[model samples]
Each structure stands twice: as structure tokens, then as C-alpha cells.
Target: MTDSITISVDAMGGDHAPRAVIHGADLALRERKNIRFIFHGRKEQIDPLLDEFPKLKPASTVRHCEAVIAMDEKPSQALRKGKNVSSMWMAIQAVKDGEADVAISGGNTGALMAMATFCLRPMEGISRPGIAAIWPTLRSDIIVLDMGATIGADARQLVDYAILGSALARSLFDAESPTVGLLNVGTEEVKGLDYIKEAGKILQQASGAGFTYHGFVEGDDIGKGTVDVVVTEGFVGNIALKTAEGTARQVASYLRTALKANWVSMLGAFFASSALNALRRKMDPRTVNGGVFMGLNGIVIKSHGGTDEVGYKSALGLAYEMARSRLIDKIGDTMQRFPVNTAPPELPSDSEAKSA
Candidate 1:
């Protein structure tokens, strides 16, 4: 629906640089007729992969750069010292120059966030950009925000995250009035820390304006489908996400082993084949491969570092949907309506915030 949306991907950002990344670009081209990709990395690294998939020749283009920022490098140091780093710098430049609708990477999380914050900057009224991850719930998906972005946030920042998360749920999932819940240790109003208690009060008072503010939601309520949006600071949200992911994988593994243990169970597995397959599909991380960095001037999707072709393709699919949805403009307009009360905390002075 968008005017042939172009996505710029960091071809060498992940652990399986060039190969997996190029395969992903090829997959996106083959599947989406209107989408184009600008692969940023070394030509030597990507040329062979492109040669293997000739259909990618016309639909995609590559911008060659020499340097590479390693996975372990500190984000601030990388941004300053690695000026010519192919994936890092090119991805930023492409978005800034209006050459791409979105930029995606499966590289270092800190570096990617740092690059995005510097290159695109936050929207006019956004204090700091937040990351939103879609978690599977019983009834529907829950959109949780500030997932490792702003670690220790104030009451006002939490409220801002709630607004941003609520808008995302409304826009992306078409929830008329999304239920917003604050993640806390207990469901009681006065159970959480001082900051959380204060945030809950503010959210409860402002309920009728935007979303349905459900007082408190504990860790047990995450996948129970109790709330549509869960608002928490980055530290807790990240831990929650990682825990959910690990638990899902462990459950699947245990099921598989148990089913193959005995002849009786093997027979049961046959009868439940379709049901098990459905469950596996629902739980597959590849199906939900893209995570959006909200409150930014441009659309940015972060893929998993260990993603294969399937995950890569899914990211591109997400990018296409986000572009068609006009999410950037929608988010900008939303920020204009409900702005952050306080400005973001300033970055350390010695750290130079480079664009790419």
C-alpha cells in the first residue's frame, strides 16, 4: 500500500553475517513485489550470496563499506571509533538520507539503539525512545514497552511508556480501548515501589482519557491475557521477556522428549499431531521476529541475532506492514497530542553522539 517501501538492512550485523542476512534480503524480494532492500556491508561478503539467488539481482541493491563494529564493542566507542563500519554507519545514513523507509539489524542491541537515537532522534515530544515487544497471551498479544531501553525510569516516564504502548496497541492491533496494566510485585494498589505507586495513581486518574487503566498486573498475569498493554521500566520488562522466552522453549523441549519416550505416548503424539503443530507455530519466535523501537522519527525493526532466513523474512514482512500502516506519521501525530512532561536525561558529555 505504501509507495514501494524500501528497507535498509545491515547485512553484516548478526552472528551469521552476510550469509543469513543476504538470504533474508532475497527472501523478502521474492515474497514482496513492491519492496526493495539496500544491503549495507562489504561487497566481497555479499556478492557470493547474491550470486546464489539471482532473483535478488534486480529487486535489491547493495552499498559497500569497509569497516565493521564487532559484537562486543561498547556502543559509544563503536560509534566514535568505527566511522567506516559498514553496517553501523550505512544503516544510519540510509535512513537519514530518505533512501529507506525503515532500517533493521540483528546486531548488538546497545549499538543499534545508540545509532538510532543519534541518527533519527526521538520524536518532537518523546523524552526517550522505547522498545515494544509483542508477547503472546491466551486471548491475544500483549504489547510491552521500555523493554531494556530506559533502565531506571521515573513515574512520569512510566506514564509516557503507558501512553506510547497504548497507542501502539490501538494502531497495530485495532484495540478500541486497550487495557493498560502496570507490572508490579502484587495486584494491590500500594504493593509496588514508591515510583510505581505514584505512576499507578497518575495512570488511574488519567484513565478515561486514553486507555483502560487496569490497576496492577503481576508476573503470573503476563501470558494470561488479562491486559493488552503492560507498562514497566526496561530492567523488569527485559527480565520478563527473557524469562518468557526461556520458559516457552523449555516447555516445548520437555513435551517433545516426553512424547517420544514410550510407545503409548508416541501413539498419543500421532493423534495430537495437528494440535501440537499449531501450538508450536504459535510459540515459534520466528513468527514474531520483529520488535519495534517506538517514539523514533523513523520506523526501526530489530531482529534476533540468531535469526535464520525465516526470521529475516518475517522482519521484512513486519517492516512492510509497519510502512503500509503509516506508523511513523501516526506515532508522530500521537506524540503531538500527548507529549512527555519532562525532557529526557542528558547523555554523558564525554560520549560523542554520532549520527551513524
Candidate 2:
């Protein structure tokens, strides 16, 4: 626990791998001068990149691991074969061993989750983990989760998401008490799946605990900042995140086409160049690159596997911020005040399971 923050990085984890990881670390150093890096990957791959970043050289060190988790590897396969040997696992181990404040990887999401869950384990009372990501919005940004950590979350798990997400919002936004909501088809109590309704009931009763709980918010509310934190099961949350990302790209494509449609439009675009630049900044996916793993003992920031240096840098920046904010301690403190119920959701009857 030095004054300077140490971030453990999975240097061999992305599509563009050690190169992007190294470059991103260098970029992050410019933003935070008091950060150090513990890079885990092949020495041959990382050593050459150090030559390119003289400033980063002194603040960084390498731990070589021969295995690199493949992007498409199954979670089970990764755990069984590469668990302790892979760069991804070693990076997470650094966090568990108190060598780093945070871990960042542009690796297989499923594999990372598997390794992280095993190595770091869940926080004391957290039954399941949720992958939380920042959603850019008109007002500012919102945190959305269970971004595919598990396929579905039960009522209690959903409440855990609200508490966990609120902790994240408080840390990221620096708000003393942040708002939270449950994503549903409608605002009505009668709508949505049974579990979501159950979660809402619990959240409403727990509002004064630490957050302002908005009863129900639809998909459209996500972009309106209706709530600082939006909670949902992993399957739907993942789909929503992908849809939003796709929509942003589609909108950017449309703008590009419209601006070049004619001479008059092109002239209009020239006049609106500054505004367009602002719009581009708003829509850039790289700006919101990392997905924070909630309910874990330590912080792990998951970068998109295919992202470039810009996106990787954003992920590293996010990791640095979470570490600086003491996000894990905040989450633990919040959970202590708002203790999560340990009861598991009721399993469907044998007949019911067979019928579907």
C-alpha cells in the first residue's frame, strides 16, 4: 500500500495485444503521474515497447507468463488449463496478493470473469458478480450492469446490482448519494418478469439506506439519466449495451453520409465543424471503454477485446480512477450498511422446468 497506485496489466490479452496494452499504459501515465504498472506477459513482447516510452520505463515492471488466454476460449477451458499460468490470471493474482490496486485486461470477457471470480473470489456477502459499464447519456453518464457476468439474475441478485451499481456511481461520479433504477418493460408494477418486480419492491423499501431508488425505468430511460444506476439481469443488460453501441455507430455513419451528400451540405458541415467535433467526442466508444467488475474483492476493468490504443488508454484511465477512488472499500462499506440478503431465488418446480 504505497502512496503511488500500482495497476496490474494483462499485457498479452487483446486482439492487438502487448502493443496496445503497453501503449495504453504509456498514455495513462501522462494523465496520472503517480501511477505504476505491473505488466504480465512475455518479456520479449513487453521489453521492446518499453524502449518507446522512456517516461513509462521507470514506473513500470514486467512479470513474464508464457500463456495468453485466447479471445474465443471457453471459460471452463481457460480455468482448467490456463488458470495460474496465463497472463490474465497472473495480473488478477497481483490484485489478490495486494501488489496492485487494480487490474486491466483487453481479454476474453468470459475467461477474465472466470479467472477473476476464482482468484479474487466475490466480496464477503456477494453471491454473484456483475460486469458494470458506463453508459454515456444526454445529461452525463449512467452505470449499467450485469453486463453479461451471468445470464440471468434473481430478485436478490438484482438488489445486489442496485447496491453495487450505486456504490460505483458514488465512486465514479463523486456523489454522496446516487440514484438507482431497475430496467423493465414499463413503469407499472404489474409489468415485467416476476423477479424484476420483486427486486423493485425491495429497492423501494431500501431507498433511505444509501440511494434514491427510482421504481422502474424502461430501456429509453437509460439515455435520459433517469437514474444514476440502472440495474438489470446479465442477458438483457448485455443486449442493451450492444444495442446502444451499435446505435451510436449507426448514427455516426448517418452523419458522415449526410454531411457529404451534396456541396451545400458539405458547406454546412464545414460551418458546423466545431459542433461536429463535440458530437464525435460525445459518441466515441473509446471514451467509455472499460467495464468494471462489480461484487469482486478487488477492482478489475475489462477493455473491449478488439479496441485500439485509444480505447485501451480509456480503459486504463478508468482503472486508475476506480483505484484512486477506493472503489472496493466504498463497495464494501456500502454493502455493510445495506447488507445483501443471502436467500437464493426459488427454483422452478420440476414440472415447470420440464414444460418450458
Candidate 3:
């Protein structure tokens, strides 16, 4: 933690590339002077932006990369065209090369995941790496994993995610034994798919090995922050994330409409502006921006491509906290305490299934 943390950034990956990314880094540096940046992107586009932030320019080292991965590109196509050359690829490469403590990108999700896996590879004993996101809940923030990194995990893979996520909870929340839960159809033992129930059974048996298993949690439990970490396969987790985001937006829209409906409502809103502002900040998805691609040898943060500089800055802050916490090492240590071999019968490895 004493040493400066180096963050490798894909400067040209986001919708507001170079500008948003560079500004975000600068803002992050203002708060945490111990950070250094290695920006990968077109020299022409990035250099001028860096020049605008004198402080950031001094702390940053830019590596010019001509190619950029389009936001809409397919994972396979992005890999074929961008591997070894794209800004996104180069940023992640910095982590693998030990030049950066972590890599951050506001790029294509699938491409970012693919490049990270192809370049950094999975950590030892991990079958598939998953993306973990910080979710703001009614009570407190919780960690949710498989944020669409790899879809459809087996029971053992789900257990792996629980360990990976609890490690993150430990790093971020400083919880000695973070509560972990399986996201399922219902709270009952036999309520979910066979694999989910199986995963729950293993977690119940292994409670206190590293984390406290909180049994099964339904979708409502997520917003309630019923557990410190919620474990699920990518497919369900991704849908849940999108749904929550959409609901937040919908609620905000409803509030705005109600406030503008009449003079009385508008006056009430003005009277409660401070409280409303606090609520807005709490509900903002941008405030919790980065998705940590866990189960990898190195840390990789994926930011929302359409986010502004403030949102990107939030992502950078997440990267800094994760690096400071030694998240990857924590995951490794937690995995040892909670072995997957002791779990239910294993399914074919994700890679083998993909290849077939």
C-alpha cells in the first residue's frame, strides 16, 4: 500500500475516449496522489488531453496505440482485429507485464473480458473468471459477481464465485467473514435449479471456512442488502444488474414528473432539495461504476462506456481501492480456505464446453 499504484488505462475505449478517461484519471489523482497512470491510445488524441491536466500529465506515461476497439464489436471480432495492438489490449498487457497494478477500460464488455482472459489468463485453480460489481443497497453496498463475464456457471463455478466475491467484500468492506448468499428463485432449500441448490448445500456446509453462508436470497433480498455478497451465474446476474439500473432510472423519472406536476409539488421538492440530492447520489449507477473482473491473476476494471468523466473517475477510484487492498491475492488466499473440489459433482470446464 505504501508504493504508488500504477493504473493502465484504455484511453480510447469509451464513448468519450481520451477526454473522459484522461479527466477521470486526473480527478482520481487529485484525491489520491499516490497513483500513477499508463495510458494506452493514440498519441495525437491523448497527449493534448494530458496537457490540459498538468498534474496528471506529470504522473502519466502514455503509450501510443493506433487501433481502438469499437463498443459494438463482437468478442471474437474484437480479438481478431485488436489483439496485441488495440488500446484495450495494450492496457491489459501492462498489468500482465507487471508495469501496472491494474488495468481499467470503458470498452466492449465481451471484448474486455476476452482480451483479459486471453492475455492475463485465469488465476491458478480458477476454472473461469467472473466480473464482480459493487451494488448500492437499501442498507449498505453489496458485492455481486458474474456480472456477465462468463455465462452459465456450474455448481462448483458458483462456489468459486462465492469465494471470489467474499474476498472482494473483505477487501472493500473490511469484513472478517463477509456473509455470502446464493441468488435463487426462492429462499427455500429446494427452490432453485439443481445446480443452484447444490451450490447452496456446499456453501452451507462450508460456512465459516472463510465466509458465512446466508442461505438463499431472492431478487428482493438484493436491494435489502441481505448479504454482503450475492453469488449467481452470469446470465441471471447480468439481468438483475440491468433490471436494477432500469428501475432506478424509472423511479427517478417518476419523481421528476411528480415534482413538476404542480406548484405545490414543486415547492415541496425545493424545500427538500438537499435530501433529494442525497437520494439522487445514492441511486446513481455512476457512483458505483467499476466491475472488477475477478478470478484473474491481475485486476481488470470495466467501466460503463457511455459514462461521463465523473463516472469514469468513480471507476478509477474503485481500481485504486482494489489495488490497495491486494484483491487478487485475497481471492487466492480465500480460495485455498474454501476448496471447490469438495463441492458437488463438477460440470465440464467452461472452456471445454465452449470449444465443443
* Model 3 lDDT per residue over 105-149, tens place: 999999999999999998877789999989988889999988888
RMSD of 2: 5.1
What is the C-alpha local distance difference test score of candidate 3? 0.90
Residue 81 in model 3: lDDT: 99
Q: What local distance difference test score does each model get?
A: 0.81, 0.89, 0.90
TM-score of each model, paired residue for residue? 0.90, 0.95, 0.95
lDDT of 2 by residue, 230-307 (tens): 999999999999998888889899989999999999999999999999989878888889999989889999999888
What is the lDDT ranking, best to worst?
3, 2, 1
Pairs clashing in candidate 3? none
Off by over 4 Å in 2: 339-356
Clashes of each: 0, 0, 0
lDDT of 2 at 227: 87
| Candidate of highest lDDT | 3
Off by over 4 Å in 3: 341-356
Query: Which whole-number lDDT from 0 to 100 does residue 255 have in model 1?
Result: 94
Candidate 1: residue 260 Cα off by (Å): 2.3
lDDT of 3 at 304: 94
In terms of lDDT, model 2 sits at: 0.89
